[model samples]
Target: MQDNSPAQPAVDLRGVVKRFGTMTAVDHLDLTIRSGEFFTMLGASGCGKTTTLRLIAGFELPTEGQILISGQDVSDIPAYQRPVHTVFQSYALFPHLTILDNVAFPLRVRRLPRAEQRARAMAALEMVQMGRYGDRKPSQLSGGQQQRVALARALVNEPTVLLLDEPLGALDLKLRKEMQLELKDMQRRLGITFVFVTHDQEEALTLSDRIALMQGGRIVQLDTPANLYNAPQSLYAAEFIGETNLIPARMVSADHGSSVVEALGQTYRAEGTTASAGAAVTLALRPERVRREPAGTGPVGELVEIDFIGTDLRLTYRMADGSKVIVRQQNSGGIPPAIGERMPLGFETDSLRIFTS
Candidate 1:
């Protein structure tokens, strides 16, 4: 007879809490990263994303709770003993060592034969497209090249999981974006669980299969990139993930799927929340989701300002009630709207997200 069970998570944090002297870094957090998935812990500085990554890497023990790696509880294990490797923002390569030697350093410490070490190190370097630079010193490589070497070092050990703590943070904007694509592609090829931490929202959305948007040492929302952007559960999630136009509103009627909201002296049926009728709420509207209409087709507003941002035009309008609405439309080589021109704006009901204040 055979019994079946689901595969264990690549990393699991069960009610994990980390506290410093008079300060709580990671609150009671429970999270599970699926095997071979690109998981990102994203938040601003001091939000415990780094601390959480440290805990998973066994750099810091949890004050309370357990951490499991590949179905084994390793909450108390030392960093070197865990089946995981970390790539830090600084790269931490030895300046004196050759690129191949730097990657082989881990194997050397484990007493692996020099031949095996070199073979494994070269293979890892090839995986990151840095094999040809094996003989160069760290100082001789560009920032992006050094980053790839660091990643190669981390991968040389063939760890069950890889933890990246903003590895691309040190690169310039253009190189950072280039590395973002490389990192995602590499992760896909390796099929190793990557636990990435970053404060950059765009980077997180770009590389992560799922993201945990953390605040105050706790996860505020955990979902795929698209879901986090399109269906943010709260205002913070909305404003943090992308630009949103927040408008003051009140719930006229609340239903399961849709609700009637009154805002800018007009009524609209939009996505609903748990808020009851007569509840004061906020409407989150994405600028690109808004539609500009004929002068009197919908609520009319005076275009106060227009900005040409490369591929898009940002238009700001002041409604009759003195509320401002911003719209972003693609620049299709058409005439621009003049300032002070009154035009009606319309948006689909489902595009508006209603959240109780």
Candidate 2:
């Protein structure tokens, strides 16, 4: 808190690196998190998302570089000394302590008065709607309730930043979705910076203001959910963020703000492609973007199978060139597909993303 720069970021990592023996867990990482930002670190297992989080939490000191909290360097500070609190997958609540005392644990550690601690703990529980259960033990609460109590405990400290390491990972599908919304709402209400680490793509996309997709100890892409999904810069990013068909294409023409490419045995115009003529590239098109043509008017592709996925239908069509194209059709007041010999698929020009090889 001592060091102040003009409008400093809430959390800043300057070329941060963490190594365990010969293996580097976090690479030369540089990140700046603005105040009240909900930044998520997303990746698969062993992709260093959690490690990067620990580096920020002061649980694991970086092997190199500096960590700044609100512009003050805190690289050498211990976890307890840092103005941050962590909520892990495991609730880690006290089994023997009452809910109120559990939430007040941090204040108790700081030697705060019992009256003030109780007041803060109750207020924290109220935020999570668990004030009624203040006298109950953690063992008496359900999984979701316990998780909320854990959140209450972490929030009672009112730290400069809140680090969540897959806190909703332990919940079931329904509960997890509910918790994701609740957590995001809480962050907005508190107006505190949140550094969340999760492997779940849907969770990251739904809750994060911006996501850092890490791979092999490095951030592969850092952007908003829509931008990362729509305009990925690389093949890995395009494929990893969501379901998209990557069609190999050759750029036949390039123009300002738009380009034409040959894909799937046909010519297609794409926008935002910067490839020169005759450049080989991968064209990304989402299944939802592919529209269905009237009976015989769409691309002539044999109907393979149609998957009825509740609200939407996914049609797998085999193109004439032996390549399969997946089409997502909305079940919106239209007759479903029948077993036909061939069907057609069309999409908008802007939906086609061109990535040069």
Identify the leading candidate in terms of lDDT.
Answer: 1
Model 1, runs deviating above 4 Å: 1-6
lDDT of 1 by residue, 185-209 (tens): 9888988889999999999999999
Prediction-by-prediction clash tally: 0, 3
Cα distance off (Å), candidate 2, residue 160: 0.7
TM-score of each: 0.95, 0.93
Residue pairs with colliding backbones in model 1 are none
**lDDT (CA) for every model shown?**
0.91, 0.88
Per-residue error (Å), model 2, residue 75: 0.4
Query: Which 10 consecutive residues of model 1 have the lowest summed lDDT?
Result: 1-10
The TM-score obtained by model 2 is: 0.93
